[model samples]
Target: MPTPPRVLTIAGSDSGGGAGIQADLKTMLALGVHGMSVIAAVTAQNSLGVQGYWELPPVAVRAQLDSVLSDIGTQAVKTGMLASTVLVETVAEVLADVTVPIIVDPVGVSKHGDSLLAPDALDAVRSVLLPLATVVTPNLWEVEQLTGIKVDEENRLRDAAEAVRALGPEWVLIKGGHLPGEPVDLLFDGTSEYRFAAARHDNRHTHGTGCTLASAIASHLALGSDVVEAVGRAKEYVTGAIEHGFPLGEGIGPVDHAWLQRR
Candidate 1:
């Protein structure tokens, strides 16, 4: 049998199994990739919110990256929450030499509005990490945080994507999930553009949507999809996951990573 496409996720661990590393790995598996991980931080998180987090030492982060890339190489990589400036730099340095397509979810906050990326790390992400990304996925909130470009309204969303694109990633996807009306996510490479619109499910349980979307994109790229095709397919998969999203704990629940099989 042919070996499964291998994918790597370098992100924080979400104890709730809703986002971060858990979500990324689950999305990879659901999309038919062999998921590998490098835990950059561990969070005390649940349906409610992020209570606290502790970043792994830079040395440990590097070690894990080396361990994965040295032997079980990945065809694609997805990065979620690297919680600190040091962690961001560490990940950026390691990923710089990797030739695989990288999908970076510039995770800035949790579903409950808790900050995940360190303020000090924003510059590192802009300078070091974004350059190494094949694509950077940032929600409206993150778009403002990273680029000082406010996506306060729909009209300015494209301006925000261009600002993020200016930071160096070959592609930028500014998710407009927080905006009113139907959810519209815009994906732009320097030249062309693609807009993905989905009927906004009224459900409030979309805790892992960001992580899942980025990993799904990485998985599609690993499967040989072009940038536009990968983003299109990832949007479809995430929409299905959101549609099947079942409520979990007292607060927000997770997107159903296994929604495909369950159907």
Candidate 2:
């Protein structure tokens, strides 16, 4: 039997199956990778908005990570929605021994504008989690949340990328979807920089975009693609997902994770 490309997601759980761990696992499966998850938080949410959330105890989170990494092994690891400082530190400690590529999705807020990260956890994420990242993916809001740099236009993206690169990641992918006009992302890898631009989709069902993009990048990385190549394919995948996003509950819906499979 062929060895399957394995990717792990350390993130919150979305009972609605739109974003968080649900979206990450869906993206991995759609991209032909075996997906594993160590949920950090459990959220009571749907399209309308987040109703409640509970952070998993650090011990439980560590146990799950230990079980997965010690047995199945991960080719790549992607993280999202660590609710508290303790959770962030716990994940950082658990991943210290894993040698594979790590993709950090500095998830700060939900698609519905609900705050996900605790104000106290910013320091832990910046100091501990970011250094272990092979690629740190931060959207516009998250960049400002983490670095205090405002990204108003294309030019400021470089400034923001630079601020995040200073934190210690090998690469930084600053998503510009929240900006106007064409959607573009800036990637900086210390010595070099690359910009990826895509046509903006007019769809409103763009939930789970951040999680899906990060997971897709991890999937490509597990498949042996380089940073640039993995990011390029991930952008293409997310664009398609956004264009075909699905309308679910009463509010913003989820991106169409199965769209690629049916094509």
Candidate 3:
């Protein structure tokens, strides 16, 4: 058998196996990519929410990254919750020289309204992390936190995308999942823009959508799709996952990462 395209996720671990590194790996597998992970933090999270999280030391984070990049170079890299200022800065620096595409999911809050990022790390996320992203995927809340731009209406997604693009990401994806209407996402690279819209699944058990989407993009990118194509494919996969989301643990359950295979 031919070797699958390797995709690496540098993020936190979710004990719930619903989000963070677990979601990333699952998405990558669904997309037919070899998934690897360098865990930056570990969160005590479940269907209910994140109870607590502990970030690995900067040195340990760096070692794991170096261990991966030095031996098995990846075709794409995805980033999720980095928790602290030092971790954010260190991850950015370590990934700076990477030649592959970097898909950054600016995960700010959990599905159950828990804060995962440190308050002081906002500046590091803006100054250090955003600039290094090949594609930055931020939800409405993350957009406001990172760029101070509020995306109230679907039409204003461009304004938010532009502001975020100015932060140095090659592409900016402003997610409109939280908006009133159908979930719409605006993808822009300053000169050109594309919009992807999907029927918002009414299922309230939609946890891990953000992490899954970004990882899907990385998986597609690793499989040789361009940024726009990757995002489009990812949207389709996530929409299906959301639609088929099953209830678990008496709270917001995770989207079915294996929805494709199960069908």
Candidate 4:
């Protein structure tokens, strides 16, 4: 049998199993890729919120990356929730030499409005990390966090994408789920632009949407899709997952990564 395409996720462990490393790996599996992880932090999280988180030492984080890249190499990588400057820099340094697709989620806050990325690490993300990304996926909130540009309406998405693109990523995907009306995401790479729209799923169980989308993109890239094709495919997968999102604990639940199999 042919070996499956390998994809690596460098992120935090979401104890809730909804977002972060858990979500990324689940999405990878659902998309038919071999998933690997380098846990940069551990979160005491649940559906309710992230109570607290602790970053792994930089040395340990580097060790995990080296172990994965040196032997069982990956075709693509996705990053989220580094939580500190050192962690971000450490990941960026190692990933700089990797000649594969890199998807950066730029996870700044949890679904419950809990802060995940530290205030100080924002600079490192802009300077060191994003430059090496094949695609940088940032929600409106994160756009403002990184570029001080607020995107309130659909027309402003291009502006947000441009601002983020200036920071160095080859492509920028601005997630507009937070806006009113049907969900629309703008994908821009300096000149070209593509818009993906999905029916607004009124499900409140949309916890892992960001992590899931980024991981799905990485999976498709590993499967040999270009940036545009990868993002398009990822959007479709995430839309189905969102439509099938099911309630779990007391608060918001997770998107069903197995929605395809279950259907």
Candidate 5:
């Protein structure tokens, strides 16, 4: 009777199920959207750290995208962890024709501090992928990687946001989770800027936060929420997720995806 909101994640696979495609799908489901995935790489990772990764061929990635977009028709698309420059370009090219909000999570590293994006792929992301993004969600490290701006203080957040917007994304959300004090994130849409603040949860199990935030934004955008509202809602969701985050392994565990269920 009603059309379900369709969302797609073109990203890597997390064998640990804490982040990557696993987190994207979980976040989409929590926000009442139909989730789909196109795996770009398969990672051997756990809470301890990333052990190894092998990227899928460009043809396989394209085939997955074509199959999904041809049938389900996505309302929004989110991308993360394009492991190589070739994969980055391939994803950008395939999604160029899709008329949906694109949430790009420039995943540069894992929660345990292992590199995700290759050194050579940075330029590809900056030149090819960012221009097509509806919203670019970058964590503090990613912002530094993309723009060479170090975010040390609150005022520096604006600088980071401005630097990211210069690359062509309609909006940029520079996550300030690494900054000291309350959890604060900066959102800039060229003309306007918004700051979203949440209580800094003292939890270490925050593995999937970036993936969850991007997918949550995609879900909200598909539901017709504006950039500011979508980001605000996404931040609130992530905050709650972090507050109830649980320990899964010896190292940092994952934010509880079933947080809403607990509440």
Candidate 6:
């Protein structure tokens, strides 16, 4: 037996097991990486929506980061809903000096349109957290939230990417899934640009798509893929997962993380 590449997720926990830390860990396992978690918040969430959430104390978050990084350091890191200004700052401070690849998924709301992040915390995410990222993945709504730029058309994805790049991340991935037609995501690092397009599955059960994609990217990075390659592979994996998505609760369901294994 050999040790697998390790990836850590710093995020909220969704009780429903569809998104947040749950999805991150599942995606890591599917991608053949060991997944570790540092829970920043806990949400009473299900397929219907988020009822409420509680943020852990800053000391607890710091302790969790130290406990993981000090003993079993990870090869890559991925972040999701931090929920508050202090939590965002706490995570940013700890991840500042980490040399491994970092993936930032600026989760603003749930699949059912429930707000997950505090409005006051947006500045900290743009200033402190995003700059420490090796790559920042923001969907259309998040892009508009972080940088006042709304991407309504596929052609405007570059504009949104550039706006986010100015915030200091080495790479920016603008997810155009909200736009009409097939989903097209643009990846840019100031100079080089790459676009990944996937067939849109006509399924309404895409609850954890964002979390799954970001975690898959982190997993591939931990497994020695470059940023471009990692994003490409992640896009493919998520497309399959979306295609195989199954209904869970009464509301939206989750993408199948083990879609590959099922086949």
Who wins the lDDT comparison?
A: 4
Q: Write the per-residue lDDT of candidate 6 for residues 3-121, one digit (tens) a residue.
A: 99999999999999999999999999999999999999999988899999999999999999999999999999999999999999999999998999999999999998999999999
The true-versus-predicted C-alpha distance at residue 193 of model 5, in Å, is 0.3
Poorest lDDT segment (10 consecutive residues) of candidate 5: 177-186
Query: Could you give candidate 2's per-residue lDDT for residues 1-263 as a string of tens digits?
Result: 89789999999999999999999999999999999999999999999999989999999999999899989999999999999999999999888888999999999989888889899999999999999999999998899998999889888999999999999999999999888889999999987999999999888999899999999999999999999999999999999999999889789999999998878
Q: How close is candidate 2 to the true structure, as a TM-score?
A: 0.99
In angstroms, give how far residue 136 of model 3 lies from its true place.
0.2
Q: Estimate each model's TM-score.
A: 0.98, 0.99, 0.98, 0.99, 0.98, 0.99
lDDT (tens digit, per residue) of candidate 3 on 66-91: 99999999999999999999999999
Comparing 2 with 4 on TM-score, the higher-scoring candidate is 4
Candidate 5 vs candidate 6: the lDDT winner is 6
Clashing pairs in 4: none
What does candidate 5's lDDT look like per residue over 115-221, in tens digits? 99999999999999999999999998999999999998888999999999999999999999888888789999988999999998888899899999999999999
lDDT ranking, high to low: 4, 6, 2, 5, 3, 1
Off by over 4 Å in 1: none
lDDT of 4 by residue, 1-263 (tens): 99999999999999999999999999999999999999999999998999999999999999999999999999999999999999999999999999999999999999999999999999999999999999999999999999999998999999999999999999999999999999999999999999999999879999999999999999999999999999999999999999999988899999999999997
- Tally clashing residue pairs in candidate 5: 0
lDDT of 2 at 151: 89
lDDT of each: 0.92, 0.94, 0.93, 0.97, 0.93, 0.96
* lDDT value for model 2: 0.94
* lDDT comparison, 1 vs 4, better candidate: 4
Supply candidate 6's per-residue lDDT for 211: 96
Compared with the true structure, model 5 gives a TM-score of 0.98
